[model samples]
Target: MSEKRIEELRRQIQYYRDAYYQENQSLISDYDYDLLERELKSLELAHGVAEGSPTVLVGGKASEVFAPVKHLTPMMSLDNAFSEEEFLAWSQRAGGGPFLCEPKIDGLALSITYENGVLVKAATRGDGETGEDVTQNVLTIQGVPHRLSGSNHPAVIEIRGEVYFPLKAFEKLNADLVAAGKPPFANPRNSASGSLRQKDPAVTASRPLRMLVHGFGSFEGLNTQSEVYQLLESWGLPTTKQFAVAQDATSAYKFITQLSQKRHDLEHEIDGVVVKVDELSRQRELGATSRAPRWAIAYKYPPEQVNTKLLDIKVSIGRTGRATPFAVLAPVKVAGSEVEFATLHNQDQVRAKGILIGDTVVLRKAGDVIPEILGPVVALRNGSEREFVMPTHCPECSFELAPAQEGDVDLRCPNAESCPAQLRERIAYIGSRAALDIEALGYVSATALTQPLEPSQPPVQSEADLFDLTLEKLLPIRAYVLDPDTGLPKHDADGNPKIVDFFRKKDGSPAEVALKLLANLEEAKTRELWKILTSLSIRHVGPVAARALCNEFGSIEKILQASEDELSQVDGVGPTLASSIKDWYQESWHQRIIERWKASGVQLEIPDFAGPVLTDGIFSGMTIVVTGSMQSMTREDAEAKIIAQGGKASSSVSKKTSFVVAGPGAGSKLAKAEELGIEVIDEATFIARLAS
Candidate 1:
């Protein structure tokens, strides 16, 4: 009788789940669904049902566009509360004297699983049981660490987070979409999900997606949620800064109400407050239904909306050569900030909305996020409204504009390296305080230096070009000067302001100014490899990644010689970025520029590091192959530690390999080690050897 009932309950539950998650149609009320799940759970417990029962799993169906992967632990949703009475009742029922409240971000759910501190898998929360693999896309997020910060952590852990697009980035994305002739995203949540699930990881990388860890899926060491939060901070993971410990039901309600009112002040979207038991033991004791943990509840708030007009559309050319479209709105306050410019996204968005230059448009801004042009006010549109069209040539460089690659919505300037606008930006970036710190030169001087040269002269297009510059040539680039005593324009014979470009005085002698710039250039040559690499303006190579590359290779020449596969072996330098780096070095123009820059005395080599050089250690002069995931640290960390101990950490196992440290998931490398008769050791023994 119980078996029959269980089977019947399963069928009904599956039907409801399919309707809610797959079809977006609710066949029953939330209360009725909860009752059904409760009945199923009771029957399962009484009859000793299998562990695979839906009573313990998640709801959403996995997307089929990518490879399907199973979750190590199910990512369950939270139960909802529509009012204070429902929430207080939940607290009383769960024995909740104290609880933790966090803002429930309205974004896509993601799971990042790390083994030995190295990020191994990133998947979306598909069905509670399965998800799609998006490891490459997750790597692109700067907030998601490639390797955990520090050591002495669990052997493995899975962090669950909400991947979101900040309001500002969302608005910018929409504007670019409008300018690219694409449809703009409706909201931050939708934009984040769509961007993260993109088939091309590079496309996803280009989007601004950030993650905030609020919980974990499967963790080996943590005992409580508070401990988890602290560990997350240590691991360099972002979390809600406004969480509070509510002592009782009333305090919890008060906190929620206060947060709800301040929601618009946040830079990202949040729909509700997630109240959960602080103690992991208490949470486990409370247990959970298949849909949500009994210890947690979401108190939802009403959505905030506003309306405004998009006055005009404009495009801006960025240094990377991507042509971005933005909206100029008639100033009106929205979401607590002054309203001026909102993003249309791209050209397709303009076409999608059928937006015209003079059309009254509906604009929305959630929180402190950048406002977006939702759509045109079709009812108010007059035929006088003009349609927007992307130009075939770049507005700044007049270079023929087209998509940088196939399947791209963005139209890019083909002459990024040589375009005056791009060059000026690049030069300024190279000279910025964050990079080489060339304090003597700034965007003002950099732009003046980039003015068109004689027909026969080499173009002054990059920061590297400045190294080849001489006092004789740059002295003539002029700026208006004022007399020091009078604070007025220094007069020439004709009563015009004296021109002083570079070091040039009214007398046309540029010697003093040229000396200052030259001295700055000399100082820049020795500014560490990481800074130099950052100043180079290589695509996708930011400060962190630049430092990683320099740490691995130690010299620009070595990095240039590295093949994509070899570059990919570096932690955080994935296939796409590796390909970009390798391809950049292969370009003939880049080759010429690098060679010229070197000849001009701009230092491109990393100085020998100062540290205790290990000698006569057991690992000294040894070639070791590290395969599989280590139990105590990341592969990159292990490799680094190995090198620190005076051993060479290699990618593959060969006959000449001195040792192979094999750990969990060891496969091909282990086989190779066996085939080659190389000495192999487990992680424990490997750690011991390193310690010795």
Candidate 2:
């Protein structure tokens, strides 16, 4: 193959890949794409073509389950330069001029193809050179546009983007999983990958996965870095918001530094910055290494690590009763803050890293957010180092720990009702915004309030006791009271509290203020049954689940008296949650607490739903699916409309779907709707239907 022909073929193949992967609309069918690829391979074989050959693979094989294929161009890993010194060295080697510094998204890399402005194919990075054809999955991502907006468009375009799960979505997903008696995912990266690799495209579509275009895999007409990014944005593709034209490496480093500080506030995760030569001509002039383009380099942020001693390893019981181990370390500075503890993740992680008590471990904070133990210093281990063991019983309640059922790794405490740790967590959760929505009783305060006094001399043993305690009793000498005016604590000349600090108030005086606060709490008991029940902190019951229970049972007293079978009958309340709730209410101590609260004049009334209910509508009893970008309103707003019209807004498209509301760049959901023979309506049609 001639050099010109090889370049043309490479460009065409790249364009097709982008169409299929980055864009949801396919201009050419799979057959045509395959034919083009085969022809390119044939041409390369015919001519001993080495430079710019379409046959130069970059991605890996598609599994048989996925149909594995290797990349023509080896998808080489970037040599990360973390500091200015390292970047300067890289730039010196490349003889740098102007560069483009872009945000480094923490996501899975993918390649996409576009033909005549229509999306056609999408694939993962896989092994870099060859990747699984994930066109179906890519279509589900919110950022990939189905069709370009402008009439004049590129003949073929290939783009690359990082697909990620947003932090909010990840947290919500994990919360839902925990509510269902399943383990939560550790982080968004793993969740994103797992969601994308699902066999069912519909399943992947349900996850809040987003895509951000970062670079061009192949392009026919685009010449400059700015032009490519602008073209992507014009096509409704999500591109990295942070991009700057730097005249030199120093400017590029400055841009990177500014972005690094703002990284923590971004909705999506970013690890570092990517600096590329701005001018396409200059990029070509400074051309390729055998691995990476000489005009481009990734400048990663230094790993924020701190040296801290492992004071102890303790097991924490989660909302699901699963016990997770974490390390309590001596306070050490890392990532601009003092960190005294880090998650051990799991037994597997602990064993893998050979972490032990008394071992000096390296704690790393990524993006100045999550702190995790890197590993122990093997050479520094001494005779004092002790192997940590997971307890067979709950440390709080002494209940036997049971192995999680199939598909779970953690052990769980069976004693849900009597476990102080479980009860405390439950109460804290209830006080959370997602639960009882209690504004006054925060997690820390709730924890302190719920804690039983000394076993030998029990104080405030029941909920009624809380109402009887004086303000002096509740206040601790060290607790600071926020001054309503300044939002800070009021201090005396010596920097002590003007009024004794809550902690200090306990110094041999009856807590009159605590008693008054207890009285206020007693008055609030009548506020709503849902608030009362939720605030009690039953296991596996979140705010939604609590509301569901309230909707089923009329009041808190009714829910408390309900049997496991009766509680399980409520919609969204499963056997596990039912058992947990039942066990909690059935306990003598818990019953005593409730009785005391009742005696203290705490009312348990159900709050009325404020929203108007649709008695009759086309949407009533219908399940609707919303997909892609809506111009008139946000996706959330559209979903709210569906719910308001008495329709059930489902995350994924299924056979039961009544209709699919699609918008610009509607992806996998649209395809799934077509496959399932479900009716698909555009934003206008959806609005019209809702009106009708």
Candidate 3:
């Protein structure tokens, strides 16, 4: 119980925590770590030691740049267990009925406060005690809900979530950084942290930052994570849809295993599973131990790394035209798959690590994803290593690349229309379900149909030819086929049919199975007209744009004949998109394809928009903030009614908020509204008001 003893324990525990969480390494076993934590807790309890005590909760401190905002409830770090044995032991100590296991996302912790169901403030988990306000930056995140819906609005709610940069986005960002002669971030977590910490809110907003609400920091009425998550969803906050309600520890472990396998598909970064008691009563019974909740523990996954030979370094031009270098590696086992490539990111990355062709580089699949060249081993490098150079022209089209606008290092392909890569990508975008309703075609299928059929041979000459593609003919088109026999492409004598033989069956005949798929596309043309226009592979046109274009022009044929000036008049269609749309329609082949599609019986009918029907009397013209629980209707449905009634549904409550709809266990929002003198209406009262 001495001061020296407490200080020593705090230092040791901090070291271990850092090593385990940040370094992904453990110096001692879970038992040893638990013992240290227990000793520290006992010392604090006996001597009333608080300052710098190991038992003192850590995390959520306000940064110097932003004014400190005190949390209604202190944010706490979760207890961690790296092994199953440790987890079982912790469960035994807690004596719980069930536990909820969630992925421990490797990202920055954030707290979003909603007033009357509208997002008002977002702050980082600065110190576990206080946090720096980053409201403006938070607004930029597309995933973060700007407004809430429904009749159930908490007066005030503080929802906690993890903001992370996805692997794909991180790679793209690092690629830009490298091309700009800047150092790439260490990992997605670091990238997310750096992005969120930017002084300029605009800079943070520009990044592909996403968030997932995992828990609540303070809720007036919400008592459990499950309830809180449901409430968050009702308020249009982004919560993980994959959360499982495990009945017991065994089920919890099973859920963890299931999530581990599926985590890679998730957009955010997750390092481990977070296990917590599902029941609020049980969680209260389990209580806390000063630093972490006894009800929750984070089950950390083992770090994954791999060794791969750098076969070559290639530069890829992005949408922005920035050339990013990546390592084409000799297939090596990492995470769960054979990683054949790792992102070199940018030129700065290549320079910093000296990544070269023929180098044996250490590759790490962080969070079980995104193969990245950790660094090259100088000792392993031979004299034959080749340096990579940024490409001056588009690799696909040889078009001169243009640098980004002033103060930007990214380069973009100025040839947006003629560039094959951009063209293909554009096709994929137009053909997406939301845009064109092209059910039979996807990016891969469309690419296969569009790619050059033979060496120096033109691709399926026109979109009309796509309709002509029979399964049998497609099998020999090496670009479209996957050989059934070898699970690899069956090469032709000249190797020119690499893609052709790929789609073929083992019998050398076009696969009947493949034919059936193409036949379905033939039938889908009769389904709708929007499908045809959306499938035209127009540049910069997505489903929303396609719909807008269709609504304005009436049909694909009409849209094509329209001048650029006329096309630009559409709600969402800008000048660039208008030119692309006009150009696509002007193409001789494109016109022929449209004729073929119409002949095939595709009908493009304008969707009928019925006038708004009001359901309730009181809700008309009144702005409502929905935050907490609602048993009557799903949040989406509730919002629809509000909008239908000419009323607005918001996410957070503010001074302008007319009323807060408080449902069962309405949390912090309720308390905040009381303080602000905002009228709080319960679900019953809300329904009554609607009826009135």
Top candidate, metric TM-score: 2
RMSD in Å for model 2: 16.0
The candidate 1 region of ten consecutive residues with least summed lDDT is: 480-489
Candidate 1, residues 409-503, lDDT tens digits: the string is 98888896778667766776777765788887675556556653333233366655778777766765654443221122446888876654445
Q: Give the 10-residue window scoring lowest on summed lDDT in candidate 3.
A: 481-490
**After aligning candidate 3 to the native by TM-score, how far in Å is the CA of 342 from where it should be?**
5.0
After superposition, candidate 2 runs with Cα above 4 Å error: 1-270, 282-311, 317-322, 330-336, 345-349, 352-354, 357-370, 374-386, 396-400, 403-408, 412-458, 462-516, 560-566, 607-692
Please, what is the whole-model Cα lDDT of each candidate in the order they appear? 0.73, 0.67, 0.66
**Per-residue error at 424 for model 2, in Å?**
4.4
Winner on TM-score (1 vs 3): 3
What TM-score does prediction 1 earn? Answer: 0.43
Which ranges of candidate 1 are over 4 A from the true structure?
Answer: 1-311, 329-345, 351-354, 360-380, 452-459, 470-475, 478-519, 609-692
Better of 1 and 2 by TM-score: 2
Cα deviation of 349 in candidate 2 (Å)?
4.6
